[model samples]
Target: MKITILGTGGGARAHTAKLVELGHEVFVGTRDPEATLARTAPDIMGNAPYKEWLADRPAVTLMPFGAAAAAADELVINGIDGHNAVAALSAIGDSLAGKTLIDYAVPYIYQHESEHPWPTPWGVMPKLDPCDTDSLGERIQRALPGTRVVKSFVTQEQTTVVDPKAIGAGDHTMFVAGDHDDAKLQACELLRSYGWTDILDLGPLVCARGMEMYAHMHSAIGFGLNQGFGGHFGIKVVR
Candidate 1:
């Protein structure tokens, strides 16, 4: 599969690396080409960081955000953080048309705030913003209009996303909701590629409201229970 991830943060980079590991042709979208090269050149040359980062992994091609969007074939996973998601999609909406977009977004972590525990006590937990009564996924779907949007991986924290093994301690659910059948199936396959076996598909994109609420509950538990322990959840079905 030809996958292009439209973000360059650590989580976005991690997704790119994992997909590359699966032998898929991968491309990373970034704002500045020169800066990305300059930052990675030292490590790639000294065979220290970038070399080690991609040592056993497949080759990841870096391109401008526009080109990456244009080159995507099977899927285009949006990995930008909360605040930037809408704008990022807007910037590349044309290329995203008719493509199956695997959206991984959450209303997590407020801007201009220090990193704190999950479900912070300062009244930060609103599953969907007031304007987005339908949820972020639905908003993006509306923004794209023609794109097939499936919301996945929003229920899990960054820690669990990079390491699914952390979900071993409990039986929790990673809720998925999308209107398209083929898109959901493809997303399920991608989730399994990341070692996530247990998935609960909650019908169409509107179910994303429930999924986001579930994230709120999970975050509350993490903040209220164990501050030292990171937030993690996985599903167990007995049927």
Candidate 2:
């Protein structure tokens, strides 16, 4: 499978590495290849810089956003920032048509630093932008008419996403939702390949709300455990 992942952050690197490890051809899509290669900021989950991550995976090709999508043969994974997704993907134009788009973007608004602290309980919770109205998945689906948009892994951090067992979390179920059945099936295979054992098929792309909103609750739980932005835990549901 020829996979193109959009973004050069932790999520993108994690997905790209796992897919490549699974024997799939993967390319990374970024706004600017030069800047992407020079990026030194830590990812949302506090992983090392993109340049550092890329150093380990020399086999992966990094290209401009549109070129990556245009080169995709099997899947296109949305690993970019939620707010930038529509514009970035829109720039790709019709290149995404007929591809299974696994969207993991989350549109969120952080509270002002003055309004909140940086520690647990109060200051640690994250706020989402489109709650009860829309989701990144629905917006992307609308942006690209013919693309099959499926949302998954919005609830997990990069490590948990690529390796569900990494956090010692047991049976923490991964949820996937999309309007197209075949697309979801293909995504499920990819998820399974990345070592996700327990997955739930939540129907329809609109259900992305629940998955996206899980971000807030997931953070709360993380902070509660003193794992603020640490990406060291996951949730497992019983029955």
Candidate 3:
């Protein structure tokens, strides 16, 4: 399986590494590959440099967005921020046709503000645009009509996404939703490959409304724990 993942952030690093371990041919997409590799500072989560993340996994290739998507065989993982998702996919154009695009992006921190006074326990939540009614995944699906869009991995931290055991998260439901049956099945298999035990299939792309909106609940719990990103474990659906 040839997989192209877009983003240089934590999620991208985690996804790329795990996919590589699964023996998938992996390519990482970034706005500027050279600049990304040249980065020396820690990321927002205080993770090591991007180039450092690659040192252990040299098999993973880094390239600009266009080429990475063009090279993808099985799926394209959107690990970039949701605010720029459409633009990034738009840049890829026809290369995404007939492909399963697994979207893991959420509203970027700054874009969380809107007229809505969406309240959370910690504070008054910023209005997340395209949420409640639509979602980042839906936007990508609409923009790239030829692609099979699956919304997934948006609620988990990068650490939790790859290693659920990192925070002792066990037998938890990882919610995934999309309109395409085959693509959704492929995503479920991908999750199982990475050791996800409980997967909640939430139906169509429109169901992404809940997935993306869960960020508030995630934040409240993380803050309550007072452990920051490492302490943040996502939703555990109990039946």
Query: Across residues 1-239, which tens digit of lDDT does each residue of candidate 2 receive?
Result: 88999997777877898888899889889889997677677765577877888788888999999899989996999988887888888878688989999999888655645355545544544466778888888989999988999999898887678888776644688899999999999999988888888889989999999999888777777767877564577777678
TM-scores of all candidate predictions against the true structure: 0.77, 0.89, 0.89
Which is better, 1 or 3, measured by TM-score?
Answer: 3
- Residue-level lDDT tens digits of model 3 in 103-206: 97876456255576655444555446676777888888889999999998888887688877655556576888999999999999999888898899999899
lDDT of 3 at 33: 90
lDDT of 1 by residue, 86-116 (tens): 7778788888888898777675545334355
RMSD of each: 5.3, 2.6, 2.7
Model 3 CA deviation exceeding 4 Å by range: 109-127, 167-169
Model 1 TM = 0.77
Q: Rate the local accuracy (lDDT) of all candidates.
A: 0.71, 0.84, 0.83
